[model samples]
Target chain A: MIERFQYDNRIVKNFLFVTIMWGVVGMLVGLTAAIQLVVPSWNFADWGSFGRLRPLHTNAVIFAFVGNAIFAGAYYSLQRLLKARMYSDMLGKIHFWGWQLIIVSAVITLPLGMTTGKEYAELEWPIDIAITLIWVVFGINMMGTIIKRRERHLYVAIWFYIATWVTVAMLHIVNSIELPISMTKSYSWYAGVQDALVQWWYGHNAVAFFLTTPFLGLMYYFLPKAANRPVYSYKLSIIHFWSLIFLYIWAGPHHLLYSALPEWAQSLGTVFSIMLIAPSWGGMLNGLLTLRGAWDRVREDPVLKFFVVAVTCYGMATLEGPLLSLKSINAIAHFTDWIIAHVHIGGIGWNGFMIFGMVYWLVPRMYGTKLHSVKLANAHFWLGTLGIILYAVPLYFAGFFQSLMWKQFTPDGFLMYPNFLGHTAGDQDGLRTARYRR
Target chain B: MDTLLEIKTAYVLRVIGGSVYLTGAFLMVYNVRKTVISGKLIANEDAEAPPLEKMDQAKESGHWHRWIERRPIQMLVISLIVVGIGGVLEIVPTFLVKTNIPTISSVKPYTPLELHGRDIYVREGCYTCHSQMVRPFRSETERYGEYAKAGEFVYDHPFQWGSKRTGPDLLRVGGKYPDSWHYYHMYDPTSMSPGSLMPPYMHMFEDLLDTTTTKRKIEAMRTMGVPYAADFPAHANDHLSAQQDKIVASLKKDGIEAQKEMEIIAVIAYLQRVGTDIKAKEVVEAKPANP
Candidate 1:
């Protein structure tokens, strides 16, 4: 017998709207931080200095902007994929409000310089506890839905979601084991080289699970829906999902190249990072190939345009990631702005464009109307594309130029451009130009 | 290329790029708002689907992947194990194996005042801009000092081998300048190095050091396996105060009147201690023979 139920578009709408709102606030902060680099005077107050603002900007964009977008897409797609409503409405509300509270606390604390000093994991001990509790609530809500799922076999998208939830929980708990000295301050339980290993293991996977995996899940669901075509291959997606997650965990040590990290671990990182391109491209190919006969629609459809570019950027950034992990190349690019350029390719290009496409596709459908203006969306696409180019290209040049200058030696064996400021000063035009286009 | 000219040109272009991106962001906000306003929200949409079947696993057979997909808990557990393997293999060795991190006999733990200074460094998020690890490269060794070693950082609670160098590496910044130089530099970076991008930390000179937690900090570090003496926490503040007084006296000798209570004194103490242990001639000579 067929059962009657209603899909929770209310929760989906709530999450999507919050995603867009936070995206603006996060990007504005990011723009401010970028500008602070060129005009040091803009870091006018202690609370707004580049050091403080940098963490705030990163956290806002990653956790607030991307984080909300993930929840929005997950809620919208998970119900349909499972053919069921969410397990509990109360749990959904708690997850939403609790997450926002965490973001708000971050906005307050980071600028005030209350941090544990770990990159991306900077929230202090109290906030860390809050995060752990909220994450468990999210887990219970998700698992409860799965147990009562109306669908017999879990779709490939749900597979990605399951992996994401499990892996992120493990990574968080292991990395956040700190010895607290006060309400606001704590030292990492692991120290020195041990600490570096754990932090990057967490850091790199945060990018993988938090940024890459959930978005891939969304891509699997939304891309097919928007294009009105089935995914290119279900088998390829299965291979892609398993290999990608397994390979990603070992690649964290690439970030610690040439540092005091053990040599064998670095080799493991290099090997696994290179192996990752296979699965990464497998997913990329699947996304792009889904649009094969739909190429004509891509030109006129702004949603398709955003998706195509998002997939292409994923391909480029994934390839660049592995290449950079190579020892010789990493030797040049590791500490340079090259790494920054590479990240933005993924950040603005892959993640940002994907979120934009998903939002445009979902908003009109949920509201029961055609888009108010497809023209405006197309314009946003062009402007966003140009902004990414202007942002990344010059930084790539600057990174290479700066690395060369740093390594340059005079005929007399003395260092050329020995003053560190000279390299940054040299890149000023590139950086300044990129800032405006952003 | 003239480096100075390029710097100025890049600065101008960055502002323009920022403007373009800002415009896109506004356009997005405008578009989404209009879409929301013109259309009514559908909070719930009607749907019908057959209830999931209760399958007989012993009788029904299919692909291997499908079995796990039907069991969410099992899938979650298997995923946990798959992802767990790498972190365990990489991290367990570094922790359990003694030789993964060698200990430098000459290296010593930070003093009470320097430890507080390090805490202040962390509190300010200085690691965002300055790196504490100097890699083994000719350019870095020439620019900063010696290459960093794992053992040198044994007492570091969380390693400050920062990823970026917006200013420069500070691993070997200790003992390179007088207490007065750090004093002025913290107050205003441009006073020491012209065209510097580092912001002036004027607030450090005014904020009082919170010495109340010095004992607790010492005790905590001991628990983390730092070799601080068992009775050290009781006298930690006295040691901190005595170090602060010496730093104040040195600042006075350089014609700068600094109070012992200021947070800058601790910062100065920490800065003066970085990389100084292994810098001694005997330590440098003793290095290769031990390991």
Candidate 2:
């Protein structure tokens, strides 16, 4: 018997709008923080200084910008893949507004100097609880839709979505175990080395499950649809999905390399991070190869162009991630501008472009019209491409220069560049050149 | 400080780059807006699909993987287990096992004043720019003193071994400067380190230390295995005020007037205490270095 239903495009639209809005806001904050590094006066008092605003910028970009994009792309794709409306419209509305509220709370509290002091997981106890609650709402809504899916076989994309949902939930609950001293203040349950391990475990997986996985899910869906092709290889998708999640969890310790984390755990992180290249590239290749015979279309269609660049960036960033995890490279690269450059490649080139591509593809179909202008989109593609190069390239050079200068010594066994500011000053020219080009 | 002038060109470029990115974002917004205006939203689109049929367990003789994929609950559980293995193996041993983080007997808990000051550090998000962990490299040791030990941070509730080093490592910053220097530096960074990018934390001088939470904080620390005496929370404030008074008197000796209750005094206490543990000869005889 045939079943007739409507796919909810309203929730997708709302999420997409939030994604674009937050993208602008988050990037603006990032640019401000960047400038604050060069001009200290821009840091206005305790409320608007680099110290507080940096977390605001990071949280906004990762959780607000990319996070909403994930939901927007996932909701649209998940519904179609499942062949069902969302299980509950109320739940969808609640999830959407609840997430926005959490972002708002972060904006208000983080700048006010209310924080738990964890790097990525910096939200105080109340906000953490709010995130957990909203996350559970999202999880229930997703699992409900999956259980009620009209399609018999779960798509590869759905599998990514499931892993993202479950893994993020687990990571959040485990890392957010803080004993609260007040409503807004709390101490981490894990102390010292144990705390470091736990925080990074959550931090690394936040990248893996939150940033990488869901975007991959979107790519798997949107890339194929835009190119009008099936995935390049079904078996490869299976291999890619499973191995990526399994390997990514152990790679957290690489963040603590050369720090006081246990040697065995550090080795585990390094070994697994190196091992992650296979599945990561597998997914990248699969996305790019989906457009194999459609090279002309890719050149003509701006959406496919965005996707092509995004997937290529994914490959480059993934390769770099593993290389940086190596002990020798990590010695120079860790805590330098190189790490910053590495993330932006994934952030702007991979995740940002993917969001652009997905949005361009979705808006037209959902609104029952052709795109506003292919030329403008192509222009965005170039400008954004230029922006990323301008942003990442100089920082990469700056990283090398900074690390070398920090390690340099005079022949008489004295520090060559004794002042830390000298190294920072060395990179300013390169950074200026890069940002100026953007 | 001469290099500070060179940073101006980079600042201009950052502005330009940011504007260019912003311009692209504006283009996207316009493009999306035009698309939205030209077309109507389909709040819901009609779709048709065959109803999912309940599969028979006996008849399901295909690949083993297909069985799990069809069941979302089972798949979620399995994924949790697979990911859990890594975190559990890495974290549980460090917590439960003794040798993972060997104790340094000289390492002791922060005094009530220093603990409050540490809270101020956390509050300001100083860890964003400065790292507390110094890797055991020749250059790092030469520049930042001794390499960091895991045992040194046992009392740190949320370890601030930060990832990035936008500023120099602060692990061994203790005893490196006078209290007046820290006071002036926190009041205005450029006064001490010329061309420093660090923001002036003038509010620390104006704000009084909120010792209201001292008891609760001490209790929380004790709960988290900090090894504070069971009776410590009851007298924590007395210890805090005593330390605060000493810091205030020392700052006065340096020709700087400061109140005993000022947040800067507490911050001074914390900074003077940081990374000074290993230098002590005996645990019972540990004393904070004078500025």
Candidate 3:
């Protein structure tokens, strides 16, 4: 006998609300960091300096905003795909509250200057332990739902979800190994060249698995649903998933190019990173193709507009990723505002747009009402798209302008931008102006 | 003649392997298309457990991928292995090979004061803005001094080779600026470098250097195999005091008060020490045995 159960929209609804709340907070912090960069006086508190708050901005945007977005979409879709409610509501609630508590701890501790100093992995020992525990709760809850599924075959989205959980759990555990000196402080297990290698491996993969893969899973589900079309190709998605996971791991070393990382590892990183363009673009094509017969709807619909820009930005960023990995390009671009443009393309354009679209799509349905304002939604889509273009394009130009100036030797081998005007303040003024326009 | 024949056979085998792989993939696509076309998807298909005896007798679950998908724990464990393989393969070999980190004999370990200062630097997230590793690029070397050697950072506990540089690289900043300059700059970055975006660390001035963990930190670094003096942990306070006295005198000369073992004094000692030890190689290389 088969007994039907209601899909647990309540848990999904909770995660969705918190995702929007935290996203605003995270963006506010990021805005402050940008402002602090332009107006140094904006560094108000002892802990409010760009150096300190930068990590907070990253952690908030990544773990809080994007992280909760993943949980919301995954939870909502996982039930529908598997044809079962989450295994245990109690476990789901535990996972929810535990994650928020950890975020709260990061807010208190990070500004107080208790950091591990590893980018993206900045949360200290205690918070790291809490993240591990909550992640396990999430994993168990997810697996339980999967195993007892009424569906015979798991969808491509579920596969991406599985890869996401397994890979993120592995990355988190390995990178967070540390020797503690105090309750709140610890040192990374690896040091110097080795540490840089490990941190980037974890760091780059954090961007891959956390920000990219889960959102791709969200796209796989939500795009097809919204467009009222079947996926463009299933076989292409399989190849995209497997190849991306395998190749993305080797590409981590590319971030350390021209640095102290050994030549062999660096070369391996470059080759694989170049190879990555194939699968990354294949996935992008797969996503955009899903909207094929619905092009007219894309123009009228705010949801599809967000997605159209998201997939296009994903394409732009992935192509640039390989270009940046090339040793020559990395040399010119690594420390410049060019890199800032490249990342924000993905950060704001891809992840930010996707989550915004997903949230807008979810809210009305969960509340069982029509959208309050289609005009407002369209306005948002245009403004966001324009802002990203305006913000990113100048920075790209400024990045090249800055690097060329910095490295330019006069015929006599004297520095060209010796006065520090064009390189620092002038280009940064371009960046700040772009930030304000946003 | 035999080598040429072997090479030809190898080439033939490669072609055969490629063809076989393509044939298998094509067959899989054909089979999948047929199955999907034959029936619509059953979104909530009712599944029942087969008899245990039959399941035991069936060594294989008829459909291999289906079997794995059904058992979520088994799938998760397999996924773990897949992910773990890359990290293990890359990292383990690097650790086993000591030559990966070149040795610099002149690079002495950090003093207690310098260690605390380094800790303070880590705490303040200075590495976020300023990278300590100077790359071999012409622009970087011309700007930051000597290109960083792997050996120079072997003693670095958590590696300060930061990925980004919003500010200038500080790997070789030691001795470039006077003690007073560091004092005023940390107190207020704008006061020193006009139009600089760095924040004021005046709070570090107000806070006392927390020496309570100095011994524990020295012990931790020693455990990491940094060569500290014998009885370093027990005598950490004495060593820090001696170092502090010198810094205090220097700051007094420059009129900054060096204020009762504040965090800035310790950070100053550390900044002064960055990339300075390798300069001793000239003297170490000149030494006679037992000197």
Candidate 4:
């Protein structure tokens, strides 16, 4: 018996292309939604309203853009790391096409108002089933490759990948259990408080495992390669991976704080969320320190600079996340533009920048040429940085403004801004208008 | 040598760093343009890293293998435990514990027409932005109304306990308006509340009421422990008709002629029932004073 390296780069390439395409689409949708906050007219009366388009933007970015990136990196790195070809190239293609199809269905249906009425887990049952099937296909291909690997032990990245797959599958299936009222309509099996708990549990971890962990896995792989250095601390990665996953699952309830969710769960969520800063920064530190000797390279290399900024942004977002989870802070942040600022900081600054860096590094290697224009790559970085700054700072101010106005009381004990619309119309209008122009 | 010295000088270093940063920034913008227009990568090459095996085989075996192999099962079990813990905490307190959700004697189930209206409200995803449950906090009670009690929602199959506060909570909407007022509000929200963000549901008025699903819905609710009569589906129509007459009379009082089968009437019926159940308790508590 002979071992051979027969991994399919084509699938990896397809996923990468889709990731970039959907990244742009998701970002544009996000930008549109952001603008709609300022210019409400842009939200036409029909399916394109803020309520409907908001979910579309989220689903496109998280599932279509980031999800594809996860698969792209996983397939590319997993094959070589395992020293084996994917279990089946056919399964890989099916998984790719199926995922893209699911994204397409989401794109169509969400705009058409076909939803389960759950945030993040809004896709109808048919598409939900498609997602489950495709996920299974992806899992089978992943597990088969692992089992048949020429190497015996799995690396830290593989552990993160395993956690990502298993946790996301559990999250998706559990949250999607609904009784169908129509082809595209369904009611959650667990209603009311139970439904809220289950949703944020799925929702928060969708951010955790789906968004954070897989990207952490990417960081583990790409950051080192870009810097021409080994990871600074293996022990830290171990601690970081486990603690992050376990703690991340429990922190979903923080999103529902001061609401109808039980007080104990809310407190539990807040505690774990606060604890998350340690492990999150540990991973960030590891990535940053990996470039300890390569800071000179970072000055010259566009790829390293992107990774540097991305890791720093991850650190900032992770730290801010814990702060925002606190009850007092969340009281002000929830349902405000502050939450918006926090999310985009993570999405555009951390995830977007890292993906850009990876594309810069990977595209050149894959195409067997030096970059056509380093100048262009540099330009994209600054514009993106500026866009992120322009996007987040005003929103943060707006969030505080909204929260203060909504909570403000006069000497007579009447609400300063008695109506919700008054709060929205105040500082938020300026922020929304600015975002719209962008 | 002097050129190297020039490059190493502070001004030269600053210029180099600045240009590199500028160049990197420019590349990002150009890349976006190129990506949009030609849809081409600046570079594409075959990946040169040794295939995955060489990397994997070089790692330490025993600890890593056990950790990786056990991860999936570990994550699944842990996630289940977390969910189960939260579930048990929520369910056990609500069900087994005697004092979990204090009962309010005045709280009663909705009338048949109101129940139908509540279902419509849910189907329209009103709770996506509006909450019906108010906690015993000053902010909530002041903003909405009296704090919500568990018994008020006893008959709710899936409680409309909304999460987001995109709109104000509707927990105490009962008696806030006349039957006709609700009709006009739902038809065109701006007419009732100026500067309202709520989308107009004029289509609800245009779309014929679907009574076909009423029986199945009742059956489903009954299965979910809603206290309904054994022959509730058989009497659903009679109950609906009687309730429709009352709503029509109320609407007529406000100079609005509403058909018995109109969706607006059903929605109005639901709106009127919201805080009414809790008001009954207050009336009972005040009965001693009257006597």
Candidate 5:
């Protein structure tokens, strides 16, 4: 006998609501940080200084905004893909509330300057323990559902999902191994070059697994569904998944190029990072070409427009990603605003757009009503596209200008622009004013 | 036709390699089962899908990978092995190979006062803007005196060689300015380096260094392979006071004292300690003429 069960979409709805709330909060923190960069006086007391708030902004965005979006999408899609409700409603609630509590803890701790000083892995020991526990709960819930899945074929999308969970767990555990000195402070297990290597291995891949893989899963599911078509090529996707996972892991050293890290490891990172373009494009092509017959609908449908831009941004970033990893390019671009511009290209364009598209496609269906304003959604799309362009373009110009001035040595090997170019072209106040109401 | 044959040969080799890896993994799993499964099986109250007995018949007709997919346990284990292999390969070698980090004979451990100041630097997140790693590039070397060597950071507990460079590198900033420059800069950064984007570190002047933790921090450093001289921790307070008094005298010459026992003193001590090891000989020769 076949038993039917309603998908526990209430959990999905709760996560989706939290997504909007956290997105607003995270973006506001980020906006404030950008403002502080331009107007140093805006830095409030010690707790509200730019240095403290910068980590808060990053944590809030990565673990809060993007984190909640992943949960909402995963909960909704996992149930439907397996043709079963989540394995346990109790576990689902635990995962949801537990994650929120962790984000709340971060908000309180990071602003107080209680950090391990590692980027992305900045949360102190107690919070790190909480993260590991919550991650296990999430893993058990996911694995439980997959085991009891009524479907026969595990889709390529699920491959990405599985990789996301496993890689993130490994990254988090390895990076969070710190010796605590106080309630809110700790030291990394590794020091000097070793710490840099390990942190970037965790740091670079945090972007790969946390930001990239899960969203690729979302793209696989939502892009095809919205376009009313099947995927472009299943064989290509299979190739894309395996090659990406294997290649991405070796590319972390690219972030440490021309630094104190050993030359061999740096070279390894560059080679693998460059090779990543092949699989990245394969995934991008799969999404874009899936809308083969449905391309006409893109003009009217705001959701499809978001997916198109998202896929295109994915293509641009993946292409630029490899180019940036080249030793020649890295020598100049490593610490400059160019890297910031490249990251925002991926962050605002790819991840932000995908989330917006998913939210728009999902919200009405969950609420059992059509969208109240398609015109407003269209407005958001243009405004967002324009906003990203305005934010990224000026920084690219400034990054190159600053880099050139820094590198412009006289024939006698004295710094050419040391006294003349007194002020750095590093003013990024342009970023503060015009972000998408993200 | 020749290229096609080569491709087929590569594919066959891959099949052989993959099978060997998987078989070894399966043997380990079986070995664990022999030890644990015979002891006890935990009662799992989990819902499970009905098995498809048609797998053998359908293997010739259906997607080959689906057989493993239907068994989530096998799939999860396989995924774990694949992802786990890379981390093991990269990290194990780094830890085992002592030659990866070449030591410098001249490099010495931080003093008690300097150690506390380094910790204060960490607390301030100063690493966010001012990087400590001076690369071998001509631009970097010209701007910041000398290139950094790996062994120079042997005693930096968690290594604050920050990735970005919003400000100038600080690895070689020692002895570059008078004591008064740092004091005025901490009070108001714009006063010293006009148009600099750095914020004033005013609170550091008010907050006294926590002398209680100095002994514990020194002991911790010794445990981390930092070679502190014997009796260093016992006289840590005395050493800190002597260092503070010297800094106060130096600042008096410049007509300012941020505070004799303040956190600012500790940070100044740490900053002055940087890049001084290579210059120790020159300093000793010129010490009589410096003041």
Candidate 6:
């Protein structure tokens, strides 16, 4: 009665390559955007301006790079965990090529100024449709594999993957509903406050479903395997999974606090966001404790080192997310680089590092050869860690500075930085002069 | 027996928590090692062992078990519960709390032309960069004049309330500028305010305003509970013409000449209407003293 099958590692390998390539590209764009903030004139020209390219950089990294990486890891890990081959390799390829096409389209369209102007969901209707189709292909492929899985009693990671797939589908479909005035332009089906609600609901959860959950799934699978241990607690995994999913959705309204969203909704967002800390840290604790009695191994292994740092960063980001969701704290942090720093902690440290570790582990097995160089990987690891610190620390200072200056009042009760332009550009010239001296 | 029981209980919890945590951690590390230690990844030789083979057989036998299959549905129901509860909590209050938004007597809905102009503004992604809602904070009051109340936006179909403050709030810009000033500003933002970051809307002047959708838009607004007169759409053109005449006369009074058809004329009308209702609450005209 035994059934055995071979997983298509090739599709996973393809996705892994895309993840690395896009990761580098996305980070470069992010670095460029960061520089543009300090030196506004760097890419101030019409086509290359920060406004046009910011979306490009974000989409490139989030969707093109990190997104593909998530798919690669998920598919490869899921099949092995379930003791099955993928349900459809053809569907997998279609999903892969379709996603890449969408990324290409975004790269071209956003710079051309053909945007609906929603953050994260910036692609116009056509590209949005393409994303939807490709997403469905991925869903079908994933669901098909699950249906044919040899394992009963789906693992905690599979639960997360299911939630991610369903929730992302719901968020994308709901938020992308627009009445097109042109091929490239459209109005949201829900306008005004309703639109704001829907957009943030999708936006915040996009981080949750698209960014957080799948990565958590990856962590669950790869972490135990790396440390050569069974999962620490099955019951806690169940609790963490359900609690995180439930609390995460309501936390979206926190992004709209003190804005036009109803006060009650904002309050709901705050309450749920505060509640999120329990489950979030539960998962983080789960991740870290998996390495119990392996501290020595961690010191010797760059993979374990990356993972340790990644989980710790996850803990930091989850804690900061709830704190930032608080109205009082958000007053200072909202729209500032503090939010940027917080996000990168997750992006670079948690998601980026974890993915890097995953790729390092996966590539060798697939290639049927020893790694080309452990030293190179260690170098990449150190450089990446340094890059994250260099990128985030300055932004933290900048965010704090911005908040203080914006709120600063003159002796006569006028704003100390009254002119918005002046406030944004304050001391730029001086900074530039100092840079030149250096 | 008690000491053994206590130690056993503690050990159990620690193992549970620790194993879960370790599993999470190990997976991430394994991923890295798998990539770094490039060599023939020896597949688990035990993966083909007899006990695992039996477990795999048992798994296949019950793989389609209904209870096992229902997990995704259960997860879906839970997801729905979370999102649904939040939605109801948010929607119920905005619906029930009529007293939360006290009405201003002078606050009226936008006329057809003004509504069209507002749509145009939204189309150009102005709200992405500019905010219209003023918070109750002291800084907001001093900068934008008069804090915004929920009632002010009651008639707004999709509230134009913005999230970011990259540009100043436009809540109180009504009647603050002459029509000619708006004309020049929209045509070329730098012409009016030096170093203004707002993009010019020069195309507004050349693009013929699409009034064809005006009736439909008004009808949609009316359906959303705005108290437009039943004949409002039928007389929409008449009202638009009258509004344009009033705007042109006001412009001339300020030594500004403008044709009624100019896009600036409509945008001026929209801007001039901002924060006018709040003026009735205070006897003091809240004008910039230096302007």
TM-score, chain B only, every model? Answer: 0.91, 0.90, 0.75, 0.72, 0.73, 0.70
Per-prediction DockQ comes to 0.51, 0.53, 0.14, 0.13, 0.12, 0.11
Candidate 3: fraction of native contacts reproduced: 0.27
Compared with the true structure, all predictions reach lDDT values of 0.86, 0.88, 0.78, 0.72, 0.76, 0.70
Per-residue alpha-carbon lDDT of candidate 5 for residues A156-261, written as tens digits (9 for 90 to 100): 7788888889889989999888776667666677777777778888888898898899999999999999999999998898789878887888888888777767
**CA-based DockQ, model 2:** 0.53
TM-score of decoy 4: 0.84
Candidate 4: stretches off by over 4 Å: A423-438, B1-136, B148-166, B234-249, B257-267, B271-276
Residues A1-438 of candidate 4: C-alpha lDDT, one tens digit per residue: 453344566787788878888976776676565445434456665577666777888899889988998998898788767777788989998999999999999999987777776777879889999999999999899988887676655667777787788878888998888777568766567655556677778888888888899999888888888888999988888788777876787788887787656677788889989999999999999999999878999988888888898999899999999998988888777766577678878887788788889877766555445666777676667766776676667667766765666676667776555545563323332233224324
Which 10-residue window of candidate 2 chain A scores lowest in summed lDDT? A428-437
- Chain A TM-score across all models, in listed order: 0.96, 0.96, 0.95, 0.94, 0.95, 0.94
Clashing pairs in 2: A432-B10
How does residue B255 of candidate 2 score in lDDT? 89
- What DockQ was computed for model 1? 0.51
Candidate 6 local lDDT, residue A13: 75
Give a tens-digit lDDT track for model 3, residues B158-241.
888776666778998888777877888898875655557678988889999989888888887777777887687999989898
Which digits, one per residue and each the tens of the lDDT, describe model 6 over residues B1-291?
Answer: 222233223323322332333233334344445554555443332232111333334434433333433345576556666555655556456546755456666667889888767765544555555678776777667656787765566555445665555456788877665666677677766565545545556556776666666777777667666779999988887888899899889778767777787766777777777666667555434445434
Candidates 2 and 4: which is better by DockQ? 2
Query: What DockQ number belongs to candidate 6?
Result: 0.11
Question: Model 1: per-residue lDDT, tens digit, A58-117?
Answer: 888888889888888998898999889989999999999999999999999999998888
The CA-based lDDT of model 2 is what? 0.88
The best candidate in terms of DockQ: 2
Best by lDDT: 2
The deviation in Å at residue B69 for candidate 3 is: 5.0
lDDT of 2 at A96: 100
Evaluated against the true structure, the overall lDDT of model 1 is 0.86
True interface contacts reproduced, per candidate: 0.61, 0.69, 0.27, 0.10, 0.22, 0.15
